[model samples]
Target: MRVVADWARQESWGVRLEWGLAGARALGPGSACVVVVDVLSFTTSVSVAVERGTRVLPYPWRDGGAAEFAAQRGAVVAVGRRSVSEQQPWSLSPAGLRRAPAAERLVLPSPNGSAISAAVDGVPVIAGCLRNATAVAGWIVRQGWGTVRQPVSVVAAGEHWPGEDLLRPAIEDWVGAGAIVAALARSGAGPLSPEAAAAMAGSVGITDIPTLIADCASGRELADSGFAGDVAVATELDVSAVVPVLTNGAFDDAR
Candidate 1:
């Protein structure tokens, strides 16, 4: 095993924030809990599905293999947002998931959020989004995770460039992560790292987050692709009380 500098790990703080897959890897090892923020879709969809009592298995890739993985688990696999149809409605879109019939389990795949969630190991993984940010924070505190002895890492699962490996550093996910960090701070769950504090501060001035999110690049892309309702569903701040925590290889309501 290669030794990583403690500085890179943000080891001094109770709560820390980082971006994308590399971020999750850098901070995940020492964290008591890692909150995965993918506000535009993956985490948001998990929130919606878990709220409706569905266990969501986050598949790292949205490829043909996802169906096989779901089939092995006897779970319904979610298709792409634009692929939802009359016979098969479940997709990465939160609004679509909300409208889909309740199932015992679902396999939701994504290149960003689900990839991050699937990569992190050992520590408890909690899905955090705009709709359940406060709830997720409180649950982390209740689990005694956000303390100096047992730190928490908040990871923003940013989007990838089309057909590219480059991360987009999505504003919506940054804000979503900030919302959770802010809530955690309010609950006295942190001696937050500078990065975490910055995330919280970033969320402090967003007085019109709904409009800001809707007008953002990812949001506009989804809107142009006819998934505008997904954006609307994702921007509903703190409306959900469900905290979806990954347990036994799947996300289920922990609230």
Candidate 2:
């Protein structure tokens, strides 16, 4: 297991890319920062919440435990998209969070992005989305991460199959991660692993990112369920200057 893990680490490269919670774990150790991307929503929602002055806590599950977790921290727990109401507008939907009143703190739970964020330890965890990709990359470069001595890992939080833990690699997340990787490269971060390079290449020629995101499987899933607004919010590329960085188990604006 150790041998397999070491081989998968991509440790020789300054920038590495991998998928889901397990990917976060594999690349987390010794890395200076781990960036988690979930465009069709978790990271996107985090960007919105943090931009609104909310400290976002990444909780791994949306189960009842999330309520207790939020209670312990005196924070509100964001509900599922379908569970959102006028009285409980805070949800994983970026659109919902955009319209919700500003919160001092929020416990945002999800199986993908939030789970990956919660799983990474001993390094800075950054929330990266289309909205803040350039900001995130600039922050990472400024911190002198993504070098041979201090590597950076970008983890794509792909969706899980309904009623199962099986991961379905969502294209929106791939491109979202790609946006960060590409930005990092442009910011002078180097020696990208093949996986990271592939992710960067994946985002390269995306002329109409909003339309691409809206037509993707994950985007369509949200759109078909009457949450098209969420997709719209997630596709606002480079519009945000807030860099949400996890410190003390909560994500807040770093710049």
Please name the candidate that would achieve the greatest TM-score relative to the true structure: 1
- The lDDT per prediction is 0.92, 0.90
Candidate 1, residues 194-237, lDDT tens digits: the string is 99999899998799999999999999999998889999999998
TM-score of each: 0.97, 0.97
- Candidate 2 RMSD computed on C-alpha atoms after optimal superposition onto the true structure: 1.3
TM value for model 1: 0.97
Model 2: per-residue Cα lDDT at residue 59: 92
Please report, as a residue range, the 10-residue window in candidate 2 with the lowest summed lDDT: 1-10
lDDT of 1 at 198: 90
In model 2, pairs of residues that clash are: none
- Residue 33, model 2: lDDT of 93
Top candidate (lDDT): 1
C-alpha RMSD by candidate, in order: 1.1, 1.3
In model 2, how large is the Cα lDDT of residue 109? 93
